[model samples]
Target: MKDIPEGCMKKRGILFTDRQQDTLTIAGLSLQERMIRTLQKAGISEIFLLPQQSEEAIASLQSTSGPVVCLTTSLLLDPRLIEEFLDFPAETTEGLLCVVPRREQPLFPLPAWSAPADDTVPLPLFLCPPPLLPLLVEALQQGVQSFPALFTYLQERTKIRPRPNEGRFWYWVRGPGDVKEAEDALFQTLVKETDSPITRLIARKISLRISRLLMSTPITPNQITLFCLGIGLIGAFLFTIPHPLAQIGGALLFLLSTILDGCDGEIARLKFLESRYGGWLDLLCDNVVHVGLFLGIAIGLYRQYQVPFYLLLGGLAVFGVVASVATVCYVTLRRKKGSGPFFTSVVNEEEAKRLKPGFHLLVKINDLLARRDFSYLLVLLALLRKMDWFLWGGAIGSNLFFFSLLGIYRWGRAL
Candidate 1:
């Protein structure tokens, strides 16, 4: 049992029936662990678990002064759904017993309980006020162990309000079939709802396929990031060798690295392994790779032709990359503070309205050019042995994009 501040509702509790213990392991973690993590992610600090016939169950009542929510451990529930229910606004006197039902459907064959006035069906989850504990205990003693039986009993005795489960994301993990269904559903849920054109068409598809394969292994997202880093550095090294074959090989390697870069994020999301450190580390590694690749291209060009122009172009291109990244970082930080973690290729609707028309147009142009897909063109140029043209184009494009963004941002602020 955990303590809550004065007047704050007692933290949510998970009630694990004896039968659920055997099927607790799903997605490499016990249901207890998964539920606890889900609560933590939802900013819930205090929590209590009521294991069947445990001393903690008795102690939980004595320690916590507020309501206790009892949910079965057999179900793999979505944390967002739980959070929404807990945060739902209601009058205190409306009901002492709250039931979450299957979305728009009844649970059992109790036609009397399935009144049209009810919005949600009674699932295995319930929130019982401290005042209703004795009644709950008495009902349990009377062999009312099942969720539907308990809900029916509560409805007959007290004002029980049914809350609808809008997103039906929970699954009862009872067998191998359930496990397979959960894996597929969770993978689908992990995919980003919106993405850039290139990411949607290429990187996302590649990443999802690779992520599905990697999830079965013990490989971590950080390891994937390191692997990408190694590939990118190798690409840079190849670019430094003054030969057409080396140049083409480097270009191919760079493209491969870009494709694989999506894997780290995909795996992290699929496994709920995302962290602030991982996000920052990914950004840092990408910047380092960009710098190395640009510098290597410049060095290789100068070595082949002994020209200062290639060196200058390389320097400019590297600067452009740095400047563009810095600008994006600054913008993301501001947006995160103002809104949330909304870092997309194109500006969101609200953000678009906030920007000047000129700035918005420039942003769209930058979005078109500043994609990983654009690197495919670089690879094609390398294969054609026209690396010089690619270098010049890169330098000019990158610099223009950065300066335009900076100027537009400043102008918007002044306006």
Candidate 2:
């Protein structure tokens, strides 16, 4: 049952006052502040702000003429706030509302208020449930827009997945019942690409060709691993050359290596070629080639300039190698233990359903990366080189640490 009048939905203002003096230590302030901004953008004008005080509560509402809702942290878990609103003249109380954190016991010892048995007007005694942000906006919109259609709309749009761009754990940050719109945006993009004939033809054709080649050859996954390693080394060698043509050659070689990386896997899968040695070899080759390719480029550039950038370039190479090694180790460990690989899951139909309507078009945005392997690393390396050496190094360091922990945990679990 709702605690507010069903018809009064618009012209609503939510008063957000925090008990904590220091904003820095507030656990979820970043998320709460984001929510506040979202509300403001929705055009709710009068957002009353105050430190915690029982007496000023009423005065706060009196100052705002529109419907007023009180938002307090756990410290303001007082029931009298609700009783005070109930005691006010019904017309004023009609717009007064209080939102408090949930508790095991009643927050205030005030007398309980009740509606006449048949009265349909809801009271303002809602609990400020944690993680309710997603649902709150939708619920408010439904209740405000149409009371009868609220439940139906909610049932249809209840479950949501994280946006691809938001990375991981995005859902945890959203208040309960709120959809991660950023994720939703990406979903839409992915969906629109489903209709592109070019994407379907290319994705299928490449995948099939690779499969057939693998079937015809006795080339083991280890050999595929070696092939990629050689390609990557050559790419690196080309990168060290001083000419623009050499750099272009290096990029093309790296791209070819990336494409072949996918081909090997397709061949293996199509030919029923599966082996533990192959998987591990693939992992080893990935780190070797990627690091070799980037390092070759960095050293090549250094040889040309002979500048202080040698250290920075070297740092990127070392850190990038460490990061790739860590990520591969972690992923391998996770796979052995039947756990998810960090940062991504195997794309499937379930993922397809979770995608938003407008964003799926991005799937067909082809590049050298549109295949089975981790070619995304190459692009990142290029961008990092252009942007800043420190950024490149930092990205490598962070990725290593992040994936290392996952690997360690999975390794422990395996034992």
- TM-score on alpha carbons, each prediction: 0.78, 0.38
lDDT of 1 by residue, 154-239 (tens): 77887766666776476655555566666776666655655567677777778778877887688988899889889989998998
lDDT of 2 by residue, 142-247 (tens): 3323211322333344431111111111121122222234323212222222323443344344534554445445666568768878987897788677666676
What Cα-based lDDT does every candidate model obtain? 0.68, 0.42
Return the number of clashes found in candidate 1. Answer: 1
In model 1, the runs with Cα more than 4 Å from the true position are 1-10, 15-26, 30-32, 53-70, 90-150, 162-170, 331-371, 404-415
**Clash number by candidate, in order:** 1, 27
lDDT of 1 at 138: 58
Instruction: Give me the candidate number with maximum TM-score.
Output: 1
